[model samples]
Target: METLRNEIQQLKAARTVNVKKDVQALRATHAGMEAKVLKGEKDLNTLRNEVAQSAEKAEKALETGALVLSVLSTPGGQKRKMNEIS
Candidate 1:
């Protein structure tokens, strides 16, 4: 009976060590995944900012183009009126 008890104790100790190792491995994997998620979020924010800036620039350019077109067409309209009268 004493020998059986000793064997049982050793098995329990070995099992405990294995459980601790598995826990450590899981913690490491969780930390690595968290870092990757944070990096991805940072990258996404940068891309969003760049897209917003690009959109603003395009809007400004379109507004400027429209104004220039309206200015140029005004003179053309006046000429057309004169030509029509002639």
Candidate 2:
């Protein structure tokens, strides 16, 4: 009975060591995943800023185009003046 108890204790100790290693590996994996998530969030914010800037530039360009069109469409504007001079 004593020998059996010693064998059981040895098995239990081995299992404990394996569990500890597994826990350490899991913690490492969790840390790596967290880092990746943070980096992804940073990248997303950068892209969003770039998109906002691009949209603002596009809006400005559209406003400039509308102003040009309105000026050209008005009576006695540049187009009518050019036609009269021609």
Candidate 3:
């Protein structure tokens, strides 16, 4: 009877160690998933920034083209006479 009790106690201790190892493995898996999510979020933010910058650059180009067209269509363009000497 004493040997049976000792065997039972040893089995319980082994089960406790196994449970702790399983818990640690689960924690590691969770940490890895969290890291992946954070990396994806960072990449998403970078893409957003690139899109915004491209839009701003396009807007500025359009404004510049409009200004040049307005300047060329005005009377000042034809009024310029550099060939006439005083």
Q: What would the TM-score be for candidate 1 when compared with the true structure?
A: 0.78
**CA error at residue 58 for candidate 3, angstroms:** 2.8
Whole-model lDDT for model 1 versus the true structure? 0.93
Q: Which candidate tops lDDT?
A: 2
Worst 10 residues of 2 by lDDT: 76-85
The per-residue C-alpha lDDT of model 3 at residue 52 equals 100
Per-residue lDDT tens digits for candidate 1, residues 1-86, read 99999999999999999999999999999999999999999999999999999999999999999986776589586676668779
Segments in model 2 whose C-alpha atoms lie over 4 Å from true places: 80-86
The C-alpha lDDT values of all candidates are 0.93, 0.95, 0.90
Residue pairs in collision within model 2: none
Tens digit per residue, CA lDDT, model 3, 7-86: 99999999999999999999999999999999999999999999999999999999999987786687765344332422
- TM-score leader: 2
How much does candidate 3 score in TM-score? 0.63
Residue pairs in candidate 1 whose N, alpha carbon or C atoms collide under 3 angstroms: none
Q: Please rank every candidate by TM-score, starting with the best.
A: 2, 1, 3
Q: Which residue pairs does candidate 3 place in steric collision?
A: none
